[model samples]
Target: MLDRIANIIVELKAVTKEAKSLARKEILYKDELKKIKLENVALRGQNATIIKERDQAIKERDQAFNNLPLKDNPDNRKVKELLFANKIVCQQRDQALQELSIKREELLKSLQEAKIAKKDRDISLSNLDEVISKLEAYQNICQEVKSKISQGKRVDADLLIEYAERLLFEEELGSTSERKLDYLENSYMFTDQASINRSLLDR
Candidate 1:
């Protein structure tokens, strides 16, 4: 009977010890569960922050889409503006080239007209030279005639008739007026035509 009681007492002691160990394990498990709950709360806060940021981004994107035209883009508009400007530049350049061509044509025409005018001037100068030559020859013959008359040589009948005819012609021309005297005084100098400008010098 004592041996049976001893075995019963041993078994009861083992059961009590096992109960205490199980109690300690239960406490540890509860602590671990509390930590997990705290971690879950932190994760929930992070998730909320991420969701808030995503919502704000979506709102801004929707606002931008509603404000802008469907087909409008900044880069596309800039390229079109550049193309328009380039077309304007091309037009201006072409207009300038056309104006330059017209100016060149006008310049060429002016050059041709100037060449023609130069030719006319050269012809006029040549005619004036021939007239000067004839006047010089006439002056030399008159000088010879005057010198012979000064030496008391009588002029021929033909010469006398010519002189008479010239005097009669001068009377008909009205140069016998006082204006002839003024003309002789002002223009009978050596600068008249040739070196023998002595016709009106003896006024």
Candidate 2:
């Protein structure tokens, strides 16, 4: 009977110990729940203050905006006019730049054309000078030939050699004969010195 009582006492002690542990756990859980509730109340107060400040800031900014001038003010109209004038000036500047570019291109083209024309004129003048020199040499040779024959003088071999390549046109020597240059070169008056002497004496 004593053993049975002791077992019953032990079981009762275990039950009491478990109940105390559960009580301790319940007290800790209640404390944590109270702390969480306090933190939530603090957060709600902070949120309410932030909302009030935001509302006050918005109201002040709106009232300040209402005190400002409207768009129809004189100063605003002047700013608009200045902006329009600036736009017009920019357009005119662009147009002038475009015209300047076109004029520069035209000037360059004209310069190139004038340069080409000048070059052609220079070539033509050189050719005319060469032709004129040849014509003058030919005329001198014909006159020497005529003079030597009429005066009975021996025409030099050098003078005959020069006329080998020279011809007298009707426009140059006023001769109506249709004789070519080589035909005159083979004539008696323009041959060797012996032929020139005989031809001159015969004249």
Candidate 3:
């Protein structure tokens, strides 16, 4: 019975360790989602600014073209030259507007992708929250079992701990290690667990 109690304690420790890891991963994912959202907003703003500038350029080009005298006159050469210059300016403005349109389209696509990513992040965060809550509840149950053990109670702590361990494993906490690292690196708010652990150890 003592051996069983010891095993349960060990299993509880492992579950708590995994819970910590999952919490860290959840934080990283949340941070990354925030960054993606911010980038998406910035890109949208840039697209709007580019569109406004393109429209202004088009209006100015049209006004310039309209101001030019296209009809043949006494100063035919000057008129022709002005018309030719106006055409070149209009062409250049049109090209710039086309490029801006293409850029705006690309930004829009990127924003859409970011939105999808944010949704996925939110889902993952929700799952993590659920897992964390379950883990906390299990931790409390383990504490109760410890109290029972201390009081010379005959609770099946071993079976309870084993069930909790299975629950932890069922959550698939280890699967997010790579994803956590990826988001940690890509996220705007930098977080380094190794550095944090080292600092804590140093203290």
Candidate 4:
């Protein structure tokens, strides 16, 4: 009867210990559940804030897209006007270039004409020089002939005839040629008019 009482006491202690352990586990489970619930509540609040921000961003993007001009809008007309103005400027530039080209051509033509006129003037000056030389040569011949006649020297008939012919044919003597011909016929030692005439005709 005493051993039975001891075993009963031991069994009571074991039951008490197990009950305390289960109570402690229950309290821990409740604390963990409370923390999870708090975390879930916080996550719900963060999700709501994220959704509100996403909706606001979408609204702003839509409003910005709506402000852009459509394909056939009046803003496109402004672009067309600008293009037309640019075309007009380009046309004016082309016209100015054409005028410049025409002016350049005119200047070149004027320059060529000036060159031609200068060349013609030079040729005329050269011809004038030749005429002056001929005049001087005729004057010298006349002086020589006059000197020979005044001094009563024997004039070379052949030389005088040749010089006269040269003045008449090979060169231009203007009025001097006529005077010298007359002087030779009247004052020279040609014995007769026929001899002087023959010498003149021989040329």
RMSD of each: 58.1, 51.1, 18.3, 57.2
lDDT of 1 by residue, 132-186 (tens): 4333333444454566558665434333334434543433434443643343334
The count of residue-pair clashes in candidate 3 stands at 0
Against the true structure, candidate 2 reaches a TM-score of 0.39
Q: On a 0 to 100 scale, what is the lDDT of residue 25 in model 4?
A: 60
Question: Which prediction has the highest lDDT against the true structure?
Answer: 4
lDDT of each: 0.50, 0.53, 0.57, 0.58
- How does residue 110 of candidate 1 score in lDDT? 53
Give the higher-lDDT candidate: 2 or 4. Answer: 4
Q: Using lDDT, rank the candidates from best to worst.
A: 4, 3, 2, 1
- Better candidate number, 1 or 4, judged by lDDT: 4
- Residues 48-105, model 3: lDDT tens digits: 6765766676577557656767662336665586667667666766665576667657
Clashes of each: 0, 0, 0, 0
Q: Could you give candidate 2's per-residue lDDT for residues 163-202 as a string of tens digits?
A: 4443423335332244443334445445466776565465
Best by TM-score: 4
Give every collision pair in model 1: none
Q: After superposition, how far is residue 95 of candidate 2 from its true place, in Å?
A: 1.9
Candidate 4 per-residue lDDT over residues 135-202, each given as its tens digit: 45555666767677688755656656566567646745453656666656454656566766775676
